[model samples]
Target: MSGNIRSSLRGQRGMSYWSLIFYISGFALIILFASKLAPGYVDAMHVENGLKDLAEKGNIRDMNRGEIVRDLQTYFMLNNVRGEPTKSVQVIRGAEGMLVSIDYELRQPLIHNIDVVMKFNKQLNTAKPELCCEPLVDLEQYRKRD
Candidate 1:
């Protein structure tokens, strides 16, 4: 009776070889998907942050549509953003401020004949400055005085 009990315990010690292989394969697939998709998400975040930064500069309300597009292109270049330039940035003037919008897409190859595509849209409202006030002293002048 004791030998029979020990034999049963040994058989239940751990997962079977086939079960371990299945679990490892599933985890590998998840990691592969994440590695392929993470860069696109990161780039989208960078684009969003760049739009916010431009809005915070408090000059978008004064720039024309063309100027806004040029500014966005420059920002993308500065930040090393990767994607095709299909749609340009849109700048709409409003009663209280300007609305800047960026719409774009990214495509990456996953496996044979398979690709991952992502689309993103980011917008921001930049208010016009109420007053144009110069600093009390120029930085160059202040440095010379010091």
Candidate 2:
């Protein structure tokens, strides 16, 4: 009877240990997924808002550069929480017909506290650029500029 009680107690302890492990593993997986997907989700939102803002404020020829910049900043704030702008915007105006360029950055989430930069450029409708760029590349370059 004494041995049986000891075995039963040991079994309960073992089960408790396994339960703790299971909970920890589940938490880790959740964190991993959140870290991976959060950045992409935030970026997609920024791009969508940027495009909509651009379209609504149509006729780029008539749009005010400062207004556009303000719109972009507003969109970034509305969509992005993890990464946000930190630097004064660098607006490269046409010099000798040089195309205008805008650069911004976003600080994103990662397992090791990594950051991603987001960038957007309005240049001569050269090559008929895509209506929207992907979230990973230039999107990161134009994220919440810092």
lDDT tens string, model 2, 47-81? 55564455544455455567656756776677663
TM-scores, all candidates, are 0.69, 0.43
Model 1 ranges with Cα > 4 A deviation: 1-4, 85-87, 94-96, 127-146
Runs with alpha carbons beyond 4 Å of true place in candidate 2: 1-27, 32-40, 77-83, 86-130, 134-146
In terms of lDDT, the poorest run of 10 residues in model 2 is 120-129
Least accurate stretch of 10 residues (summed lDDT) in model 1? 129-138
Per-candidate clashes come to 0, 10
lDDT of 1 by residue, 11-111 (tens): 98999899999999999989988999898787777777667667667556667878877877888788777665325465666687766666667788888
Per-candidate local distance difference test: 0.68, 0.49
**RMSD each, Å:** 13.6, 8.1
